[model samples]
Target: MKLTIQRHQKGKSYEETFDVASLKVTTLLAALYEIKAKMDESLTFDAGCRSGVCGACALRVNGRETLACSYTPHDGDRIEPLNYHPVQRDLKVDKEKPQETLKRVLPTTIQNPKSKIQNPPLSSEDEAKFRVQTDCILCDSCYSACPVLAVNPDFLGPFALTRAWRYHTDPRYIEEVPNDSIQHLTSKIQNPVLLDTVQQNGIWDCTLCGECTAVCPQQIDPKSDIMQLRGESLKAGYSDPTLSTPSFGTPDFGGGFGFDPNAGF
Candidate 1:
């Protein structure tokens, strides 16, 4: 099959079409591998956990970021590297910094004071609720789907923020520990929007566009999580700089984003 890859090298961006299906399974990475092994030995890309567990293989498929190893090849799919990260070669980009940003944001779990479930027990219902979030393999599809990270470098990507929410939302993490070091850290340093910090570095910036939700193979809805995060922020008295009248349905944090409380979707 014929493949067109968006290539970047030496500060230039261009596309290179190659005939690789003369060889492999047409898996996106396999096709690229064929081209690299048979045609251009110098071609470069990064991949690991070919099953999609590792986000290392992330790339842009027709202008959207997706993990190359996990993406099945389509006849005319245009393959490019991920945006918002430095391209290291033909289909590889550096994702560490963004992932690190999430770490800086205190991405972890915290138990709610009212949670009935205990950490060790891990009730079936609560487990089901968080199962999808736990399935995230760091494929970075959510990061690719995030609109805020597209324009605002300061806006931490979904994986990081979502992880933080997982910790805070997990009844286990928050149990009996009214607050801990992480809470303090989320309150002070990393201070992500979803991590219950006072500043605007977290959820307030999320557009909740559902792109992250759509691209997630594991079915985690970072968009919904982000919206829930907004509610958490509001209850915490986090003010929306963009909101004026403070009225209901006012979209107080209208940084170009969504939903009245009852309309949570």
Candidate 2:
């Protein structure tokens, strides 16, 4: 099979093609290894766990996000680094920048509102609330497929928003604190600061395009998580900035036809 790879070196970008004798079940990572071992020693990419579990080998194949370790390569397949990330080398992208959004959005640890009770109990139902979200492997496939990042680089992308929703909905954070201390009573309320942080270039900025969900290798639905965040934001007395605009409502027609007949066309 012939594979065309997009390569970046020193400050230049180029394409290189290599022919590999591959079996029907040969994965893209295997093909890359073959090319690197026999054809070009400099051929570069990232891979770990050789299975899809690691998510370290994620890249763009045929202009779509996929794991190199799992996907079988077709003849004439074009491989490249993930979109919206700085290419470290051929087929390798710097994920640190994209992942930094998580640190900026989520608290270092879950803040238990019930201060009197250390290690609050979490029921099965509470665990199920954000269970699927916890499966995120940080593959960054969702980040690669996100259209929001194409235009708004600063926009907190899908994974970060999903993580924010994960912690926000955590029952530990929402449980009522004991009335032993006045400070505890005041802190019993939900985290408005988290909602506030996600309001700008965050949840509201998401266009609800399901691309992030479609590309997530782990089946984690970031799009749905973002919607849940929006609902929580509304419940917390926060509104979508776009919806609050003066131009968003229907125009009054003075009980006449939609348009004034007296006005000349």
Candidate 1 lDDT score at position 95: 73
The TM-score that candidate 2 achieves is 0.85
Q: What lDDT score goes with residue 67 in model 2?
A: 96
Please give, for residues 1-265, the per-residue lDDT of candidate 1 as tens digits.
7788887778778888887656766478877777888888877898888877766787778877677777788778788777677778777777787777656645345544455655567779867766777777876767766788767887777887777667556656532223664454344322233344414556767766778787777778887777766766655555666664345454545534443556566
Each candidate: what lDDT?
Answer: 0.68, 0.82
Off by over 4 Å in 1: 107-119, 175-194, 245-265
Misplaced by over 4 Å in model 2 are: 22-25, 108-116, 174-189, 246-265
Model 2 alpha-carbon miss at residue 15, Å: 1.2
Model 2 clashing residue pairs (backbone): none
User: How do the residues 125-226 of candidate 2 rate in per-residue lDDT, one tens digit apiece?
Assistant: 989988999888999999999999989999999999999888877766642333334233234336555666788899989999899999898999999999
